[model samples]
Target: MTLDLATLFFVTVFMLGLGGVLLLFAWLQNRSTTALAWWGAAFLFFAPATALFGLRDNLPEFWSIVVCNTIYSLAYGLLWTGARVFEGRRPVFLGMTAGSIVWLLASQFSFFMQSLPLRIVLASTIVLTYCLLFVWELWQGRKEGLMSRWPVMAMVGLHGLFFLVRIPSVTSLPFPIGANSPASPAALIMVFGPLFYAFALVFLLMALTKERAELYQRRAANIDSLTGVANRRGFTELALRVIARSNTDKAPLALLLFDLDNFKGINDRFGHRAGDRVLVVFAKTIQQTLRPLDLVGRLGGEEFVALLPGVTPDITMDIAERIRDSFAAAAREVDGHRVSATVSIGTASATQAGYDFDTLYAVADAALYRAKQKGRNRIEPGRPSLTMVSQALES
Candidate 1:
């Protein structure tokens, strides 16, 4: 079936309008990502631009050529701005408006306005620039690991290539300005191409948003709300992976379990708020003392764990001591209440405690108990049981 210009124009408008409404609904559902709002507006602008293109023959030259193309250019510019916002970059309002400004000024020249080839090249250049800018913005966020980004990039890239080829194709064609009728081949291809592009992009954009939402949901589940560290479940999953890797590589790994000393007394004297501040301070201190490769998690109230890969028992002991000293210093006073906080740490190493997280945690927990029994604000070492060694080997 042959697609007439009117059919293509209505399809383009429908797709753009549908995309805009869906994106607007998405934006309303989650107002955090401003990119969605911008993209929604872009699609809205594109719907009108497509409608204006279909009505160009009935409208004045200024409305048909200058206003119509300017709106179309602004639509792509908004898409570029949305990409910039997605990547945490500042949107260029003046740059986005520049296309309309340039088109309006150029349309004032009768020769430029009357020549179809010149008009096509000029509009294509502006649109192509915005398309490439969108590509660059998405490419900048390549490290984010969004699976939908690849298809979005490919679609935008090919759209830009279409405009790029249009520059030369229009220049070589013998078509006149009046030849852009509903039945013309060029008009049909131009309208149909964007119709397909817009529909595909809407799906891809929704997929991207879904991917980000799922990622954030997973992180929220894994993260401790108060301390911003890994929760118990997250720590176990990550630490076990580290343990498995260490066992495979035959690298030394250490586990340190820590509990804040006199935590109950602080909460009783100063209140739970002060207790929370102390915990936050101690967690921060522990994070600062450890290497980036180390994993730390809050096991429960005032209880934490750290898994250190590539560290021996002696070095792990020293690191634990450092963490203890730093936390003690940092937690000396919370909200100026004169609350002195200290942490007791237990150290165990894979070489002695076996490579399993459970075995290491058991030894470390025993040593932590030993530290508490001896005195608070101290470190203790625990030896792995023979049973743990056999279990680790079997596993």
Candidate 2:
């Protein structure tokens, strides 16, 4: 079988196009992320597109070899960006890749490639340098707890180097590192290159799919299916985390628990449809008023929780006031009429007595009970619950 670079270029095009489609899927499913655009651009223009067209003019020339190797290098580098960023690492790979590709391109000068003595000296040197670099990155990934991420990348990197130097004229140069050996670079690459990179890409897609599925499972576990807010499960999770962090950091956090006033009457008079609309509208209201950094979740029907981190009592009161007014302002219009509802918020801060996630939830719950008992449409806080519990315990 006669294997040529043309066949190689054709197959990479298909793989790159497939990656572009998945990146689009990621962009649409979540909020706008910059990585999606970068991935799309890399696949569309750099990887196979350049290889297909750029290789035509310079076939078997140094530049053709350079272009093909550059694309593969760049693809590995671009693919590494996803590997790093998706797991929250600095974008250092882009700059490093630019430097590496630049140096490799600069070596194509006739003087550089022609010097038999210099070529041999530099060939071993360049090989060692890049091999060390790949090893260093692999070590870093393992140390940083990124999970089994480096293997796929290492496979891409090693195979890429194999494909790069295998250009007919170039493969023999610098005393032909692999040319003199029983195993030829072209033969080895033909045996493994396309399929190796293909396997790496497949591995990456598997990693991405696994990540998305895990994220979905985590979200579903914490969120209410009907209301799309944190359910009791999520509340326990946030509480444990906030409590553990608060004890360590000693920074103030707060929780506001509340329920709508006269909610049942609306359901009784207007129907459960109106009540559900009120819940959705209320969730929307709380979501809008609070900073995106804050977390809000519907605990159950008519009851909600807003976890506010780093807020003092005074600031929290101001927030509570706004939430109260914001909800009243957010009246629902059904079948041509404005239907009004009110809320009673129980607010508690970390610095206060019984200042913890559970205590805050309890206090807020007690305050809500009082708000309903004392007539409704108001705000209360956590001290009341602690006091009642203390008295009951003493009694």
Candidate 3:
């Protein structure tokens, strides 16, 4: 089979340019994902670099050899920068240009610039370093549980490995002298390999952006923007799963429902901003008081709930009391306003209410009403009666 290097070069340049434009357009539509812009610029840079490399015969050795390789290195470095941005880290401007600087400096030496093997080694090393850095940045954010990240890491990792292998293969195997070298197997592989990779990389980049958008939407739906905790829907979904696990394990669970006292009065007296500060204060207090594994959510305005797994009735009461005390203390002064906020808490246990979220919630809510009736800022226990029924269902 015969291959036309000029045609392939043109195709690569066109495709990379198109991909860069598309990515830049995507970034314009959603300015939050700044990584898209960096990635787009990287692709755009790659187009000119590929052009310079392919047309090396027509251009001066300085532009074709030194400048071309430096641009390629810069593109890879930008890719690493994009990875850092994607993971919410600040881009290291120095690091982004480090590879190109090193390449340009090394190119100053006539012996260094003249040897093809030496040139290939340096170029491949720079690319491999950037690829590895990209992989590491993504790996650091693995806790986010983004499924799209794994494939990106794998692809970048494999690409890095290819470069690593190429460093050794360039010396041992029959390597082509340049891109236009006639249809040698090594030359063909070198020309086509990056073309296919660029295509796949652009596809993955689009997929990654799409995944992040979906994740943000899901979080927006589930999370309470005011308190930085779960909303009612999110809490219910998570609590149901916890209930099922507790039931399967025959372990006890506890639910604490809280209602802020005089919330509306605070808004009326101190202003809505102060009321917001009080809510934020209370949420932070409860979160700090609870165990790490415990789940808490804002059920609605001025009302919040928490679910504690594997907790006894006595422990549940203790936790509820602690939360009540902590919140009262924290909400005493909100943004220089004497808010004097307090909370009434209701406690229910799986031992009494069974492993049903609704049953536990209803019982806790009743207890909360009693706490409010008994002059707020106190904890009340739910009336226990469903033990036998729960055990029967379990059997």
Candidate 4:
């Protein structure tokens, strides 16, 4: 099919303009990272670059060859900068400006400015470098598990390869070349490739933003605001998964339920703000005493749970005691006030308490109640009785 360059240019300009607007809107809504703003600028810069190319016949040779290409180079550089920012890396402004600098200096030479193939080769090399760097930046963030990132990387990588291949073809092929009208296969690809890439890239960018939003929402739902531990719902979800894994692996699992003793009294004596500090300190102490693989969560105010995999009943009790002692020592002073606090922990093992989360939780809760009844600031072993199971089932 015979492609109309003017039509392609207009379509590309419109697509780039629309994409830029959408990205800018997304930036305004989130404002979390500068990556979105850089990408928005990329699209906006690209629109005018494409427009300048379309008007090259009408404009001066210097504007068409030097200025237009410089802007185009800046667009690709910003794309690279955006990728760097997304990956939490500092954007190198000098590296981004290098391509434009090279083009501007090279354009001053009459011989360099006169040869279209030489200019295409230089511009293509600069753009390809930026594109590859963008791919590298995205690849570095692979562990984040954002699936949309893979497609964006693939698209940019392929785009780079297209330019890489074009360098050789443009150098070899003889075609009509001028500021106003450049009839060549490379020129056609240049116009059409970015149009398709821009469309795909905009959608992928939106997908990335959506993925991040969903991740934040999930964390907010599952995480305790004050303690920075798992919330009740998150604990249940994670603990259930751990239970299933333990059952399959035949590994012992233990659950420890903890409640702060005289937590209400502490709040009354030291104010709610001081009480919050005590809770934070207690949570940190619990985290320090456990293995990295172990999971801890906040059930509610002054109530927490810890799940330990591959632990025996005796070892679980010892760990619980350690946590209790550590928290008790740590909570002696909250916000420089003489606020004393202690934690009561009740532990249950999978072998004795059963693998079911609800059953185990009920046994632990019962044990916790017993510990409170006997005395605060104590660790108690859960007794998984048939009555407890029945009660859990009923509840």
* Each model's lDDT: 0.88, 0.63, 0.88, 0.87
Residue pairs that clash (backbone atoms under 3 angstroms), model 3: none
- Candidate 2 scores a C-alpha RMSD against the true structure in Å of 8.8
Candidate 2 C-alpha lDDT tens digits along 137-196: 445645444344466456546654553444334445432333333344544344344445
**Model 3, CA-based lDDT:** 0.88
Error of 2 at 49 (Å): 15
Q: Judged by TM-score, which candidate is best?
A: 1
Candidate 4 C-alpha lDDT tens digits along 246-271: 98897999999999999999899889
Candidate 3 per-residue lDDT, tens place, 110-221, comes to 9997788899888889999999999999999999878889988999999899889878777665655332334467666766766876788888988898898999999899
Q: Any residue pairs clashing in model 1, and if so which?
A: none
Residue 203 CA error for candidate 3 (Å)?
Answer: 1.0
RMSDs, each prediction?
Answer: 2.0, 8.8, 2.3, 2.8
2 or 4, greater by lDDT: 4
lDDT of 1: 0.88
Candidate 2: clashing pairs of residues: 363-382
- Cα lDDT for residue 292, candidate 4: 91
Q: Model 4: residues >4 Å from true position, as ranges?
A: 1-3, 174-185, 387-395
